[model samples]
Target: MTPQYMNISYHDLLKATSGFSSENVIGTGGFGVVYKGIMAVEGIITSVAIKVLNLEQRGASRSFLSECETLRSVRHRNLIKVLSCCSSIDHRGNDFKAVVFEYMPNGSLEEWLHPKESMNSQPFESLSIMQRLNIAIDVAAALGYLHEHGPVPVVHCDLKPSNILLDNEMIAHVGDFGLARFLIRQANISSPSMTSASGIKGSIGYIPPEYGFGSQASTEGDIYSYGILLLETFTGVSPTDERFTDVSSLHSHVKMAFPSRVLDVVDSKMFLERQCPGTKTVCAPKSAHDCLVSVLQCGIQCSKESPRERGTMKQVVRELDSARMLLLR
Candidate 1:
C-alpha cells in the first residue's frame, strides 16, 4: 500500500526555502536540487529537507515516481525519514514535484569521510575505527531490512557514501531512492547507470560486473556495490579514485596488499592502533590488523565476479557483527 504523503503548497515550500535560494541549497544531483526548509506542521514549526524535481532532467519524472513508490513501502531506522511529497504546478503555472524528508543535521557521510581543508581548522581528524565499524554495521542492518523484512525485496541500486546521511547522534540513514528497484517486478524503473548500451549500470566504479552485461538489477548487484562501499570506507578512497587504472581496481588494490600491508592503504585518519581507553599508553589487547583483514576479505567475497558466488546480505550482517565483536574485544 502506498503511504499517503502530505500535500504541501508550492508557495509554502517556496517560502520555507526562501525561494530555494542558493544559500539554502544543501545538495544537488541528477534528478533535482534539495533545499533546507522550515515549515509549520500540526500547529508547530518543523525543519525539513525538500527535494524538488528538475523536470528538465531527462529521467527526473521516472526518478520522482520511483522514489515515491519505493519509500512508501520501506521503513527502517537507518533509512531516511520521509515526511511528504508535492506534485503540483508552481504559482507561475510551471509543473512542480518535490519530496519532503526529516532534516538531517550532521550532513552526509561523504563530508565526514572526506572533509575539506579549511584555514581555521586546528587539526584534521578522521573517522575512528570504532566509528567506521558502527557505520558499516548500520548500513548492513539497513540492507538486511530492505532485503528480508520489507513487504517486498528492495534493491538500493546506488549505494555510496554520499547517499548515506548522518544525524546529530551520528547514526547512519540510507537515503536516495531515485534509482531503487523492487525485485520480482513489483515496480519497473531503471537505475541511473542503466543504459541501452552500457553507459554505466550504477555509479562509475560501484557498478556490478553483471549489470554491465545487461543483467537486471538484483540483490546480488546491491551486494557488489556494498562490497565496494565497505572497501572504500576502510581505504578512504573512492572506487573511481585516480590511483585506480584499467588494469587494477579498488578491489584488486585491497586484495593484493591485504594482511601483508593492510596499513599502507588504510586512511591515516582512522587510528589503527588499538589502545586502552582514557590513556595514551599502548594497550593492544589483540592484533587490530586481524579484524581488519577479515573485513577486507568479506568485502572481496561480496564483490565476486559471479553473482551466484557472492555472499548474501545475511552473511554480510553476520560477518560484520563478528568483525565488530573483534574490534570491541
Candidate 2:
C-alpha cells in the first residue's frame, strides 16, 4: 500500500526555500536541484530538503514517479525519510513536481570521504577507522533490508557515496531512489543475467560490468556497487582514480596487494592500530591488520566480474560486522 503524503502547495515550498533562491540551493543532479528549506510540519517548524524536478529533461518525470513509488513502500532506519511530495503546477502553470525529505545536517558521505580543499572552507576531519566501519555496516544493513525484508524487493540502481547522506548523529542514510526498481517478477530476480535494457543504468565506475551488457538491475548489481563503495571507503581511493589504467580497476588494484600490502593502499589518515586495554604501550596491530584484510576480501568478493559470483547484501553485512568485532577486540 502506498503511504498517504502530506499535501503541500508549490507556493509553500517556494516560500520555505525563499522563492527558490540561488542561495538556498544545496545540491544539483541530473533530475533536478535540491534546496534547503525551513517549513512548518505538524505545527512544528522543520528543516527539509526539497528536490524540484526539472521535468524538461527526458525521463525526469519518470524518475520522480519512481522515487515516490519506491520510497512509499520501503522504510528503514538507514534509509532517508520522505516527508511528502508535490505534483502540481508552478506559477507559470508548467508541470512542477518535487519531493520533500528530512534534512540531513551533516550533508553527504561524499563530503566526509573526499572533502573539498578550499581556503574558504572550514577544516574537515577525516573519518576514523571505527567510524568508517560503522558507516560500512550501516549502508550494508540498509541494502540488506531493501533486498530481503522490504514488502517487495528493491534494487537501488544508483548506490554511490554521493547518494548516502549523513544525519546529525553521523548515521548513514541511503537516499536518491530516482532510479530504483522493484523486483516484481520472480524470474528477473532469480536470473543473474536478466536484461531489462534501460536506457541509462547508474553512475560511471560504480556500475557493475553486467549492467554495461544490458543486464537488469538486481540485488547482485547492488552488491557489486557496494563492494566498490567498501573498497573506496577504506582505501580513500575512488574507483575512477587516475591511477587506475586500462584493465586495472579498483577491484584488481586492491586484489594485487590485498592480504599482504593492504596498508600500502589504505588511507594514511585512518588510524587502524588499536592498543590493548590496560596496556599503555602494547599495541595489537596484527588483530587490526587481520580485520582490515577480512573487510577488503569481502569487497573483492562482492565486486567480482561475474554477477553470479558477488556476495549478497546479507553476507556483506555479516562480514562487515565480523570485521568491526575484530577491530573492537
Give lDDT: candidate 2, residue 276: 48
Cα lDDT computed for each candidate against the true fold:
0.80, 0.86
TM-score of each: 0.88, 0.91
The pairs that clash in candidate 1 are none
Q: Which candidate is the best by lDDT?
A: 2
Candidate 1 regions with alpha-carbon error over 4 angstroms: 1-4, 117-125, 185-201, 272-287
State the lDDT of candidate 2 residue by residue for 154-193, as single tens digits: 8898998888888988899999999888776555445433
Encode model 1's per-residue lDDT on 198-299: one tens digit a residue.
222467888998887778777788899999999988888888878889899999999898777776677755664644477544333354566787788889
